[model samples]
Target: MPTEGVTGANKGIGYEIVKALCQRYNGHVYLTARNAIKGNAAACKLRKLGLYPIFHQLDIGDEESIKKFRDYITKHEGGIDLLFNNAGVSFNECTQAYAKEAENVINVNYFGTLHAVEILGPILRYGARIINTSSFFGHLSNIPSSSLRNRLAARSLTVDGLCHLMNEYLSDVRNGVHVTKGWGDSPYTVSKVGVAALTIVLQRMFDNDPEKRQISVNSVHPGYTQTDLTGNMGTYTAEEGARSALFAGLDAEGLRGQFVWDNLAIIDWYAATPPKSF
Candidate 1:
């Protein structure tokens, strides 16, 4: 069983990921999106390719919609083996970002994903896999500041600490204290950081639960994929960027709780040693 979200399957990386899954697994893959017309069209296109991918309408931000989709999945598919949290959004104008826009991005990218996991956790059978789409922009190295950058890069910082930092950062954003307090300026950056941190938390949680055999939860940076999210400024094709995701989604032989890039595992050095930033 394959589950995808925010898939404008006719175009971009989300579409490419679905195609790759169909080719590699040749199983029942769910194509999900909030827009029915676009989703069905994409499904039809894939159908013409002779890959019968199922289409489902899912708005990640809406809890009721998520439950409805979950119910449908339970009744029809029995259980899901993979859950790909690939849907997210961000505003174009980064410099002139507003609180509401930032909130919306965080809500969809961070909270929406969390909600999906919460509701779908029970249905994911043993040895299930979950891949969260994150970005290199969330990397601490990208921050140019000497102090905050060092703090973010520090080793000995636990995932819990990172979550706390992210909460504080967003709180600052909401209270208009970020700029004045010299916090990270971009909301997208902060939200992506939260995404990475969240992955670490889930991975560890799954790891500690001895009842299962490696749930294999990880985050991916779909490197510079040409999607509507990037406004077509990306250098890589959507299919190319999704290569890592394909590897993580299907290759569940011996891996779990890794942040991957280009189909290989990456260690969050800062997460391992949070207090020892370089």
Candidate 2:
């Protein structure tokens, strides 16, 4: 089974991930969104295309909503095979007007993703694949500011540390000090950086233990897909973007915790400057 969130998935990469999984995987797939209407609409569209993806209402930001989805999955599907953390938000143009960019973006993209993982971690089957939808913008090399780069590259980082840093960045943004102080450029960047960092940290954590030995967790850049998160100005289509995610989800054997794009591996930031495409 598969769990997809932020089902406003009306028409974008989220929808495309749903479509791609249906076409590729024969197991049960859960097409989830915060809105029931939108979730069903997207599922119905897939149904018309001869794919039978199930619709469930889920809000990654809400603990209750996440629990409800988890319970539904446990009762119906027993457990999940793949958990794709694809729900994200950005306030590029709008947050600038209100100066709430960091707050808004981190709440959805960072915290929301973690919340889903927290709720679903216990229910994931052995050998289950977890795909975190990160971005190239999340790369640390993109942040040229030295002070901010150092903060973003803090050592021995954990999910709690990452969450704390994101909150600190949000506070800076709201106080109108982050931009002037060079903490970060935008909430989107800060939140995504946290995501990418969280990806590597989680990889190390997941790979270290023998009990949690069957899980493979990884992150990927969908490679500039045309989606609402990008304001529809991306060069690639949602289907193209879902390619790497699907690769991570279904075919990623003996390859856990690797960040990828275009079906290839990405070089780490310490190894190079201003990372090139994988």
Candidate 3:
């Protein structure tokens, strides 16, 4: 039987994704969150709606938590048919120092998501699907430095190289020279850009895996959703925001290494105009 999972699904767009999967997917859907109480509550709510979704505790920021979840899936489901890298954090106000804010945001949003994939990718079933919930702001055009942009867009850029770039950004932030170094002002934006880049990198790796030929990996901009992440200031509801991600996760076959817009159309990540709603 096919099995799928979503991370950070206790609430908001992630929760909506899990709910949609339970209603439409023809297999087990796991709703995961760092907080067990909230994750179970979300699962119960789905049960009330006549949809059954299993709950799992997952903290993408913690490697131990990730390994535990991977082990459970390996033991119980054998392998995952679909995985959504959705757990993330953002700061509405820059109350904290730039360096501190950048570190915390990058830890959970980029490195954390990348680590989760590293541990789980090997167990993905043949023809599996992977979707990373990136933002339109994550487009390569967000980086103003021409050299940095070109390096990121290079076809030969490897995962290690990406990690090095992210690390360099953090180092620059720590030295209070990120802006001078041509890094973006918003750490959240940079982290999501890393997520989008990682999506393509993973897709390339999957292409080399003979056992996982048909697996498609893509990043999606879930529109501007009125979720806690946005401080409820967005134009769309959580349910509406989840539509593009849900479409990509459950459908969008053969669409690997691409950036999908809120309308579910594939866009050129480097050249497309930024979505105005975000």
Best by lDDT: 3
Ranking by lDDT: 3, 2, 1
lDDT per residue for candidate 1 within 61-142, as digits (tens), equals 8999889888998888776788888888875565465777777877787777777877877778777888888787655544
Candidate 2 regions off by >4 Å?
1-10, 95-97, 269-272
What TM-score would you give candidate 1 relative to the actual structure? 0.84
TM-scores of all candidate predictions against the true structure:
0.84, 0.90, 0.96
Using TM-score, rank the candidates from best to worst. 3, 2, 1
Q: Show how many residue pairs clash in every candidate, following the order shown.
A: 10, 0, 0
- Tens-place lDDT per residue, model 3, 47-77, is 9999999999999999999999999999999
lDDT digits (tens) for residues 1-278 of candidate 2: 44433333545777888887777776777788877888889889899999888888888878899999889888887888888888888766743364655576788888888888878878888887778888887777765577767766666777787778777777777787877777656677767767777777777777787867688888777887777777777778888888777777776677666677664565474433645553
lDDT against true structure, model 2: 0.74
- Candidate 3 runs further than 4 Å off: 275-278
Comparison by lDDT, 1 against 3, better one = 3
Q: Pull out the clashing pairs in model 3.
A: none
- lDDT, residue 50, candidate 1: 81
Which 10-residue window of candidate 3 scores lowest in summed lDDT? 269-278
